[model samples]
Target: MMRFFTGLITVTLLLGGVGTVWLFLTPSGTNLRYLMADTLITTQHRSWAKYIIGQHAMETRVQAYQQQFNEMGEERDTHEIHPDSVPAQAPAAGTNHEAETALTEKKPLVEIEEISGHGYSGYVMTVNDPTKIRIGVPEKKGRGERVLSMAERTGAIAGVNGGGFADPNWQGNGFQPIGIVMSGGELFYDDLGKSKSTQVVGLDDNGKMVAGRYSLDELKALGVKEAVTFQPRIIVNGKGLIKDAADGWGIAPRTAMGQREDGAILFVVIDGRQPGHSIGANLYDVQQIMLEHGAVIAANLDGGSSTVLVKDGQVLNKPSTKSSEGRYLPSAFLVFEHPELAEIQNVWAGLKPGDIDPGKW
Candidate 1:
């Protein structure tokens, strides 16, 4: 009888040890129902063991779950975002050549300009499929095609008005744009007669660089693209080209940008040609800093004394010439306040509220 009692006690103790381990491994939920109702848990010692084991099991369960998840493939843990899809937050404008290249792949709503319908006589084309464009300067052929600095060309005379400033024998004041082309992931057309002169022939179909500017070869090495000269300027948008030079030069190498805010795109032309007290543009000028404006891309054209803004049949700004005779420009970008354009229906459009048209004075 004593031996039978000893065997029963041993069996009970063995069952209790195994029960504790099982409770430690198992979580309390619907899955644990059978284990909870098991006769073993009804005992005081068994119930106490469950509580102690459950505390320790919680930590193990978490670690096990983490380990299982980590065992999956790396592909399940990663995602990719395209640079083009997001508006780049850049420290400075035009600095991210690679990101800029990504943007160039997408067609812009507005392009720089196009050089079509250009007869030696000069004709008009549409900007962004809207707005009329007219070129009256450069005479449209041969050397006349290139832009000359106003002060550099004493022989520059105004073809529109036959004044001393209009003398063709002398190069005149005011900037003349050569050809407008898009390059470097940007939409602006370039002008040869501007403060800086550059020609960029970029990445071609051959998968190699073709031409470049600034010696950086940015256009060639990257996906920079271009277009022809159309109405790239504001008043110059649909105006005629007039060949003439102003006797004076106001500033040099200045730069500006057209910023879009609310519903208006304002042309922020900065004067950096020379010191505020002195004349002529230099580096570090507010507008000349170039990178601060974030101009995805930009081009500098003729400026200085010849920089004239004509509106309402009158000159709006001070003409740099010592004489009020606005330098005879071979080409003039004029803004018209009255007539509207046919392309966008009304045509005369500008940043300001007044309807505007581009013309040659």
Candidate 2:
């Protein structure tokens, strides 16, 4: 009995030592500490994990990391001309002739290509005209809708998850979006008071991809057709915004959107968390992918478990969540055959923010 006990203890010690070594020596860009922290907080003993790692410390670290990357500066000439810089021009009273002509011309509406690099492999969806893109919101105010469901309901040929949602305790109802959600030129959700100057990703009436900081009124003035708000614009003007992998928002599953100079929208989704299959990708990897594909303007969308790409009623990428299908989200950018024909009703029309509880499913 004594001998057996000694052998068991020795084996346990050896395994623990090996695991610790692997975690530390894996790679320079790997976020082993974050992985451990996330795992602990997500498990049933979250209180214990918080006590061990100090929630405040973890949050401070995360903020510091994000701040470092955000301050790295944008690539020059990649951003749209400031609204104030443009001379005032008469607003067209009806349909834009130029936009209509561009839409009617023969061009590939959507194309998907496989993209790969040193540490990542994913797909880049090229949208010829940004006008065909539309934001799909959930029908119910307090409940979320799946991206696939939104795509099917809207008759979209392709769809990708959009924006961030209020995920309380990581078990949110997924009904509430964290920032603004504008579809069909109408504001459905706004949290500008809580967070000033959100980074918006959308399109103007002329099919121009609009990305940058904007207020609700500014969005209105810009004639934004479809928009959703999120953070940390990764590329501006054909240059990568993130400086390095360590500051690349802690490597994980990623979903980002960008636009080329030719008015083509780029959608990228990198699968993650499945160790042997796809560990994940950092913001730098995503930035590099965007640059290689000729993206002049690019920004990160709600990634992690919300990352998804669907085409023709089929999921294109492997979602990192246990659900496999992907999480129910508040919004998704759907591609339509006739975007002008899409009739999207405001789900949050009569409801106030207080009416919804993110903790409730």
lDDT of each: 0.28, 0.77
lDDT of 2 by residue, 273-301 (tens): 67776767878888888888878888888
Each prediction's RMSD to truth: 32.6, 8.3
Which number leads on lDDT? Answer: 2
Worst 10 residues of 2 by lDDT: 81-90
Evaluated at residue 23, the lDDT of candidate 2 is 65
Tens digits of lDDT, candidate 1, 221-265: 444432222111211111111121110111232222222111111
Model 1, poorest ten-residue lDDT window? 117-126
Top TM-score: which candidate number?
Answer: 2
Model 1 misplaced stretches (Cα beyond 4 Å)? 1-280, 286-294, 336-361
Clashing pairs in 2: 78-236, 78-237
lDDT of 2: 0.77
